[model samples]
Target chain A: MSFDITAVVNIMGLAAVAVFAISGALDAARQKMDILGFMLIGTATGIGGGTLRDVLLGNVPVFWIREPVWILICLVASAVTYFIAPKLASRSRTLIWMDAVGLALFAVVGTEIALEFGTSSLIAICMGVMTATFGGIARDVLCGSNLTLMNEELYITTALAGSVVYLLLNSFNLPNSYDLIGGFLVAFILRALAIQFHLKLPNPHRKD
Target chain B: MSFDITAVVNIMGLAAVAVFAISGALDAARQKMDILGFMLIGTATGIGGGTLRDVLLGNVPVFWIREPVWILICLVASAVTYFIAPKLASRSRTLIWMDAVGLALFAVVGTEIALEFGTSSLIAICMGVMTATFGGIARDVLCGSNLTLMNEELYITTALAGSVVYLLLNSFNLPNSYDLIGGFLVAFILRALAIQFHLKLPNPHRKD
Candidate 1:
């Protein structure tokens, strides 16, 4: 039975966009932002990473501007979150898990795109990390919430590990499906463990 | 004597890139970030807005990626700022003025690019404002500093007004030089006045 890995990847990409938008909306609700603010942040968080990646890789018009379905997904997700967030007992928890899923998906997808664009593995890995993390970073910055980059959590590291694993699988001539699934699992599992156990990277030591 | 308007725009763009990089470095100095952090923030501040504009307008490879001189300029400017920022009597004041210059130049340049790309006047103006403001916003967010969007300052308004002025001048069929110079002056003067007088936009009133 031959399955279409491309279709699976596209669906996961949409899922990532939706979850990220939901996380952004939940954040906006917590920040007491207005409806427009919720939609703006949600859309930004959904597309910021991919937009950056596409720009850097010379992919014109960006994915969202060309398809716009991604934007509609974000808007709908944000509106839903805005209405449902108040009833949720653990909005923060939900946001984090949603972010984890988005991170995993973006890392793999971004790496794949970069590799296809003929970038070196290092640049591809970096692009993956950027794609995974930049949207959340933009969301936090826009909302004046806690910055993921400022935190000691294994956030970026998870994306980096996932991208590296994906590249390694590709090097082994694995099926595209195996590469995508392996990459996503590595990133998601690492992020989940980090959240569950409060695992963190070593903090920098600075002397004034 | 007639001048090369395109050359003038290019030169001004480079100047804006340098000033923004310096501002980013100053911000990093205040935050006590390391050298790499300074470079990262500086490069982002230098190119973030134009990158966003290019991506949205479907200008692939981005300006900086095409020329790379912009990145070189940012690195040099940031390094210089790192060495000299501490000796400055007032870093914040310097940062604001530098940002104002960048804002003015970028506002005009971005609008011109969008118009050339055949965008509507409204969309072009929005692109102008975004190109002028996004770099500084990225710098602020990365530094965990104050957000321009959250603040009541007339920052975005200055860009908007400048872009409108540019579009109006274009409609009059004036020389491109006049439009560019006129746009820059309006943005700079308005921002300068806002800074000098602490002018702000009306705050939104929200009731829980």
Candidate 2:
């Protein structure tokens, strides 16, 4: 049976935007930001990474400006998150899972886009990781929180691994569907494990 | 005598990039980051604002990617600043002035580019301010410093005023050179006065 891989990527991309928006709203709630701040930060988190990737790759008008459906997803997701965040007993847990899914989807989609743009594998891999992580970094920065990059957690490493996996699978001429799913699963499982086991990289500054 | 307005804008833009790179290197020094960190942050600060503006306006390949000279300027300025920062007795003073010059220049140049792109006046003005201010904001975020946006300072206000000035001059059919210079003077002088007088906008959170 033939399947449209592009269709699946687009759908998953929207899901990624929604989850990122929810994560951003949760961050805004942590900061006790106003409604306007919530919307702005949430939208930024949803679109920031993809926008940066498209721009660097010279894709004009950026993704949100072209389709705008991406922006609508961000707004709706953020507003819903704002209302439900207070009622959730385990907000942090929800945030972690949401972020992991977003990271995995964005990493694979971004790498695919860069490859389609005819960029080198190295650049494509880097763009994938950037697309996965930069949105959260922008959210933390706007919230004036400590940078997630400065943390010793295996956060960026997971994205990097996923991008590499996707590139490897593509090189092996695997079905595009399998490559996408394999990349996403590797990233999500790795990140979930990191969160579950509190896995961290070695910090030179930390005395053992 | 007919003057090439584009040439002048291009040259001054380089100057602006140089000053911004210096400021970023100084910030890296304050954080005691490694040499690689110095170069990375310096390049980001030097080109960050313009890159965002170009991407948003759909000016593909970005200014630096098309003309690698911009990146070269950033590297040289950053390395020079990294070396001289230790000997300066009042590094903060140098930083402030360098930042002011860069802001003024970037604001006018950015506004001109947006207008050339046929954007609405309001959008052009916003892009101008974004081009002037986003680099410093990114620098502060990367350094994990208290966001300058959180301060009640007139920093963003000055860039706004400069953008407005450029737009007003263009509307009045002034010479292109005069419009650029007029905007720069207004922004720089206003910022200088604010610095000298400790002028600040009223804070809503502050009790008299």
Q: Using DockQ as the measure, which candidate wins?
A: 2
DockQ of 2: 0.19
Candidate 1 — which pairs collide? none
Best by lDDT: 1
When just chain B is superposed on the true chain B, each candidate scores a TM-score of 0.90, 0.91
Model 2 C-alpha lDDT per residue in residues B68-186, reported as the tens digit of each score: 68877987888777667776427678767877888888888889899999999999899999899888777887878766754625788888889999999999997778888899899
Off by over 4 Å in 2: A34-36, A89-91, A206-208, B1-43, B46-50, B56-58, B63-137, B146-208
| Residues A119-160 of candidate 1: C-alpha lDDT, one tens digit per residue | 767668767978987888789878876564545357777888
Please report, as a residue range, the 10-residue window in candidate 1 chain B with the lowest summed lDDT: B31-40
Residue-level lDDT tens digits of model 2 in A1-208: 8788789778878888988888888889888887777888999999989988887879867889999999999999888887787875276677668778888889988898888887777667767977987888788878877655535247777887889999999999987788888988999899889888887654322344
My TM-score estimates for the predictions, one after another, are 0.60, 0.60
Worst 10 residues of 2 chain B by lDDT: B31-40
* Candidate 1 CAPRI assessment class: incorrect
**Model 1: residues with Cα > 4 Å off, grouped in runs:** A56-58, A89-91, A120-122, A205-208, B1-42, B46-59, B63-137, B144-208
